[model samples]
Target: MSDNYSIARYLISQLRPGLQLGETVLSPDGKVLLYAGTILTEKHIEKLSYYNCEGVRVRELQSGVGMGFDSNQQRKRGNAEPEELIVSHEYYEADMAATVSEQETEFAGIYGNVVKDLKRCFTIVRLEKHLDCELLQSIVDALLTLSERGIGATALLHTATRSEDYLFHHSVNVGILANIIGNLSGAFKPSQQRNLILAGILHDIGKLEIPVHVLYKKGSLDEDELHMVRQHPAIAFKFFRRFKEIPESVRLGVLQHHERDDGSGYPLQTAGAKNHPIAKVLGIADVYDAMTSKKVYGEEVSPFAALDTIQADSFSGKFSPKYSTPFLHELCQTLIGRYVTLNDGSTGQLVFWNRSGKETCLIRFSDGQVIDIMNQNKLKVIKLVC
Candidate 1:
């Protein structure tokens, strides 16, 4: 392969069958160069003996049987037979011949700044209610600006991570995702969008008062511990009540985010007729984030799976049908064209969105192969690889 070859050009090559190796496979500096060719047998290794290349190595590979180079390694190391051989280049660049380098750079930079601003906003909220309302409003304005420009705010928010401040990051993610859902459903105006964002940012503020051990406990909560957990909504409600100037809509969203439309939620079991519209939106966003986030007890579910679960429950009368159908459909559409990593360690692009079945997507690999997630039983979507 040439240095000028674009990453998109190589995507198809990675899907090719047999042992195909590049000279600069996985190199950091991106200066390594090598040829790509198939390995017929161990005897064929001698053919390259005349080509003196330093740091040369041979590895067995299989195609269509698994996902990427990493998947091949795992299968091969686990007593699986070698079905192909792949050569790699000496160096692999991070950007790897991207078509729109400038655009990518700008997008990454903006995303980074947004994450930073979200963290700052949470910190101010934690310290006191003295945060500059205008500053908080400005952050919301910035997000809307990027969203209007066609950036997937939900995906961008999903990609950001925080190790030490899990609550803050989680809250921001919930807000961004809720705002995206509201915008997609055509239910929110500019003012409502800002309110939703603010509500999302503060939805779990009550959790701050809980003991860290209880919040981060690895095992299931006992009855007494669960009692404490249930008090968070009330704690949040009381805290917000102290701020009389805060909009009632924002406060109500924080208090009622956990309330279900079927009257099964905690504190107040408000049914569809009783639950506020903002609260319903917040509830959907809250559970979606929780189920998709890594926790002590279990790994996060795939975004597609989470959406499926919500849709299933909605149809069964567990959630409000008014908001659930459109929200799930829009979310699935937003995820089309994104790349994801499967539970089996395969990397592919999500090319289709199907809302009717357990398998909801068509994931295409580099080798002109497509995995019908709706039909494949062995593989399931695990997460969106940002």
Candidate 2:
């Protein structure tokens, strides 16, 4: 591991299930293999052994630490100040040498609940050809509701770690994102909005047909595996094509989301106005979420970087400007004043967005120095930080 990593080292045997990763673990080639805050599972441990890695790094304990909220104490205190509950790198780094504390256990328990509920919902989808709309809606509503309570979308997404069962978690994210975009664009009626959410939920229904060993593999995929994965959209389209209950917009979303404007995507080389508008939005949402979320192999880019890539794709004729322009503009507005982890491992505030520039942004560091990130081609914003 690099010396700049923000984590405490623990022996391989010392790491047990339920421990959260303090920072992202990288491959020998520097790609992010696992994201920070991901909960440990047996599969993860096995993979660690497969790579012959040494000890692992876990999140620093926060007992009696400043800026690290003591949830139990806060509950007894009635109402705590904003500063009292906020978690910060200063406090965590200061207490890195401290022993594992009880607060993380409680935090993990809360996250575990979200994961379990999500698993239940996905299992229902697998058994039935269609999702239990009410159950699925309830879970997504809870997530959105939490976001409304000032937790933000990333916080709610974090509750369901990216370490296990990515397909289901991804479906839930895309569903939430699709609903947000649809509602914000004022492009759909209330009924239309609900259907759009359902479409996002079932967009990857074909992936379930893929084998478990292949679906959850750790390393790079072989050509045959890649070919199988690419067939998912067509498989999904076939599955629900004759189901009268499924909406046309939804069926179109599942079938055409992977299609590109320039006729570059798989299954069908769909181009221009041929792709459905809803699918275009789904494609953007899908890419945005996947880029930000932890992955099985590739490195996760920061929100701004993801948007930049999407913007480049739009300019390259891979995505429609009709859908990508408004959506990216709206999303970028939400990112102003947010903190992000830089490629050089420094944390900075996103001060501005360059709408006309080749580079994406200008960021302000803690030391009162501002850097235009676009000038450095190799730099990447790792993730958005609260």
Candidate 3:
């Protein structure tokens, strides 16, 4: 309720070198402990840990481009002729704030840059015999940097409104998610993890050979079109064979990503023993990207809904329980602290997840009330909030 704060807020983690404090730091009881414009020092940040503070409010950070204090709050900074003060307030991440416009601007910056890089890489692989794996790694590195800062896949999914360049978008999305799954798999070697990411990048490369009309069709494909569509894995597999420099994991992953444990998958219909492990990772991430991304015919499903469909298939032996289950568990870990909109028209931060059951999640509302959503039978997390 105090006008003494900036609407743009930050977590304690954002307290890095060159971060200037924009407002007076206050105790929970409103007692001023630090003055306005006190540039945060290591000691000051270290003090926060002692207090067990979850986060701190600050003005825009004087850091980098697209980074800083909120310009809107700068109007209220000091003594002025008008002295207009803001009453009700909403606190949000300084980097990603309480404003829709601010979040959109940030997300657009990420989307445009990554999509451009992917387009270039896709073109390189299509036109040449050699693939620049480093360029692809650079894309994953950029996305990983954002994820390290807590602006991960869920945030991107929330910000994206449409799929303008669908292929590139899908490649980058699946790459980011595949790495997340691979890291948590506990069995994938570091090289295997890197290969998993590569697999995601090239998994759908064969689609390029398909006619644009069939590839981007807004309606169900005819039998002929469907048969052509399912040939993507084989197409990519054969194309990559020209480049002996490519990893076997990547080549086979490209070939087998659609292959299911139950043998109902496409191209080769390879299953179980024949399925490359990295392809299993690719399979899950691919389904997630497809479900949550805007398609020509249907709207994107929520992350939870996508998982529901995959898990159902997993139950029917479509995906290996040993593989798909862990992927789901680890992937869901990323959602623990994210905000979600519920079916009952309420919004909350996911505070806890019950390991024994998937449906029950503990969520904390804006008022700080934590509720186990499983008991609220009619309530389900309908979508993730940006």
Q: What is the lDDT for 235 in model 1?
A: 84
Best by lDDT: 3
Q: What's the TM-score of each model vs. the native?
A: 0.70, 0.64, 0.68
Tens-digit lDDT track of model 2 for 59-119: 5433311111111321221133544323345633433323223333343454455546767
Put the candidates in lDDT order, highest first: 3, 2, 1
For model 1, the superposed segments whose C-alpha errors exceed 4 Å read 1-135, 149-151, 294-298, 357-360
Candidate 3: global Cα-lDDT?
0.65
After superposition on all CA atoms, how large is the RMSD of candidate 3? Answer: 11.3
What lDDT score belongs to each candidate, Candidate 1 first?
Answer: 0.59, 0.63, 0.65
Q: Please, what are the lDDT tens digits per residue for candidate 3 over residues 131-174?
A: 67678778766766433322134445545635777888788777
Candidate 1 vs candidate 2: the TM-score winner is 1
lDDT value, residue 245 of candidate 3? 63
> Worst ten-residue run, lDDT, model 3?
68-77
- CA displacement after TM-score superposition, residue 107 of candidate 2 (Å): 15
